[model samples]
Target chain A: MKARVHISLKTGVHDPQGKAIRNALSGLGFAGLGEVRQGKLIELELDETDPDTAREAVDRMCRGLLANPVIETYHIDLEA
Target chain B: MKARVHISLKTGVHDPQGKAIRNALSGLGFAGLGEVRQGKLIELELDETDPDTAREAVDRMCRGLLANPVIETYHIDLEA
Candidate 1:
C-alpha cells in the first residue's frame, strides 16, 4: 500500500517561509497574488494490504513523527 | 483563483531527508515499510478569475521560481 501525509501549519501560525516565497514571486513579476502557504508532503510505502490497517498505521506515523499536532494538521491518503 | 504547486525531487536524486524519516519511523517501530519520500506543497491565492490565465501564470510561477528545473518536478492545480 501507499500512504501520503500532507502536513501543514495552522492558519494562525506565522509562515515566514511562505512569505519569502510570495515576496520572491512578486519581485519576479507575478502579480495579483494573495497568500502563499507552504506545507510538507510525505509519501510512504507500506506492506499492509488492507486499507483500514494501512490508514491506521499511517495516522499513527503522522501523529508520532510526521507532524507537530499542536501547531500542525495532517491529512492521510491511502492507496492499495 | 487558487494555485497549488507540488514539488518533489526527481527519481534517482539522492534524498537524505527521506532516508532520515524512514529511519526514524523504523525507530518508532513502524515495520514493513519501504521507501519514504518527502516533497513540498505550496498553495497560492490568486486574484485572477479566468482559468486559462490563472493556470498560465501559475505554470510560469512553477517553471521560473517555484521549482528547480534541474532535479525537482512540480505540478500545479488552480481553483476558482
Candidate 2:
C-alpha cells in the first residue's frame, strides 16, 4: 500500500518556519496573506496486507516516528 | 481563498530528514516500510478574488519565497 501522512503542528503552537515563509512572501510583495501554517507530508510505501492493517500501521508510525505527539497532529491517506 | 502549497525536494536531492524519519519508523518496529520522502505543506488564507489570481499569487509565493526552485518543487490547491 501507499500512504501519505500529513503531520502538522497543533494549533496554538508557534511555527517559526511558517512565519518565516510568510514574512518572505510579504517581502516579495504578496499582500493580504493572512496566516500561514506549515506541516510535513510524508509519502511512503508499506507492505501492509489491507486497509485496516495499513491504518493501524500508519497510525503507529505517526505516533512513534512520524510525529511528535507533544506538539504535532497527523492524518493518513492510504492508496493501494 | 484558501490555498495549500506543497513543497518537496527534487528527486536526486538527498533528504536527510526523510531518511531520519524512515529510520525512526524502523526502530519502532515498522517493518516492510520502504523509502520515505518528506515534503512541506503550507496552508494559507489569501484575499485573491479568483482562482486564477490565487494561483498566480501562490506561484509567485512559491518561487519568490515558499520554495527554493533550485532544489524544490511546489504544487498548489486553491479553495474559495
Instruction: Point to the candidate with the largest lDDT.
Output: 1
The stretch of ten residues in a row with the least summed lDDT in candidate 2 chain B is B57-66
Residue ranges of candidate 1 with Cα displaced over 4 Å: none
Per-residue lDDT tens digits for candidate 1, residues A1-80, read 99988888899889999999999999999989999999998889999999998998999998899999999999898887
**Candidate 2 CAPRI assessment class:** medium
Best model number under TM-score = 1
**Model 1, global lDDT:** 0.91
C-alpha RMSD of each candidate structure in angstroms: 1.0, 1.5
Tens-place lDDT per residue, model 2, A14-72, is 99988987888888778989889999999888877699989998898888767899999
- Model 1 chain B: ten consecutive residues of lowest lDDT: B71-80
